[model samples]
Target: GGISRAGRDALGEATAKILASANTYENQTIFLTGSKAYTLKEITSFISKILGRDIPLRFVSLEEYINQYLNCLDEYWVRLWARTYLALKREELARVYPTLENLLGRKPKSLEQTIKEIFTDKQTGEKESKLTNKYWQASTFDNK
Candidate 1:
């Protein structure tokens, strides 16, 4: 079974609605989530499709990112945090919840639609405008 990933804005909207009917869900723990689950790879693929370009994915160790960006931190803590991040990434994050839909009284946005709302440029169909130019300007590996 896959877990659903809710868009942040969608989740917020659902939360507001749920709160408005506090009497109904009072004293109960409600699970709020997107209507569907998606893996990181799936999300990346969707972004690529919307951009109409292949986005290169490069896997780098957490240590590398930390070393490059947070070198001021203590070595031991950095390694510890990186290990924790790696472990979390390896786990399943997809969560499906009916509570959100029930609370909203309407179907929540699908993962694709949610992603498009977040990443797509409505006017030009380009991914973050800056990235579009960079993506197009980069030479393909075949060219090099």
Candidate 2:
């Protein structure tokens, strides 16, 4: 399929942003996925031009992302549904907490680090009781 001019422009801009952000961070890994349409070479060319360095970037299709990251779920519909559900729950938590200070402990410097810790704890089968709906209210006192 032929790429639209507008699409190319958008991709170029996204590539530039990615490269700039990646260069700013030390030892950064960027993941890009959008079905099976995007081109790695085009993105790399733009990134290389912006960063002034030849850095290897990883590219994976949406199918590959779901297959590898979301193992237990086979159907795409199911995976998307579960993703939506989790997103809503996270939003609900954010609404109540409003800030990282409202969380059970001190906030990590990096959100990525916090997510990694959460995933590790889950993988190790650490016991964590799910938050109750009643606790969704914003409280004046830190009730941990």
Candidate 3:
């Protein structure tokens, strides 16, 4: 898939900055994104280099994808996501916009930076959530 990936920290910062600047950016819609678009292979290559281990890539047909996940997911889910897979295959979800960088006053986090933030020492200057502590609990796909 040719879709974009943005770091959560950058997205959060951008959102905060935009909200604080509501008067300056009022009534304007924006599309935020990472600086560049990457293919799955390029993304995995970043992961491989960072983790110092090979992240395997398996190219499969849409049918194969549906069949593989159909057991864990429902028939409706598997069937519905066939459209998403097709869109990804068609490069329909990929776009990079400068709004995020502009708002953050610097480049959005690189893939490596985001990965390191997640996998390395989790130290960052990001603020603690103003929301309830329960918001800190992250959910995975299975959990969600």
State which candidate has the highest TM-score. Answer: 3
TM-scores of the candidates are 0.67, 0.21, 0.70
Q: CA lDDT of 43 in candidate 2?
A: 41
TM-score of 3: 0.70
Identify the candidate with maximal lDDT. Answer: 3
Candidate 1 stretches greater than 4 Å from native:
1-3, 71-92, 123-126, 130-144
Write out the backbone clash pairs for model 2.
Answer: none
| Residue pairs in candidate 1 whose N, alpha carbon or C atoms collide under 3 angstroms | 3-94, 3-95, 4-36, 4-95, 4-96
Model 3 gets an lDDT of 0.68
What is the lDDT of every predicted structure here?
A: 0.65, 0.35, 0.68
Sorted by TM-score (best first), the order is 3, 1, 2
- Candidate 3 clashes: the total is 0
Worst 10 residues of 1 by lDDT: 135-144
Shift in Å, residue 80, candidate 3: 5.2
Per-residue lDDT tens digits for candidate 1, residues 60-133, read: 65545566445587887766655543543644445466888887788888888877876767787667664435
Better of 1 and 2 by TM-score: 1
The count of backbone overlaps in candidate 1 is 5
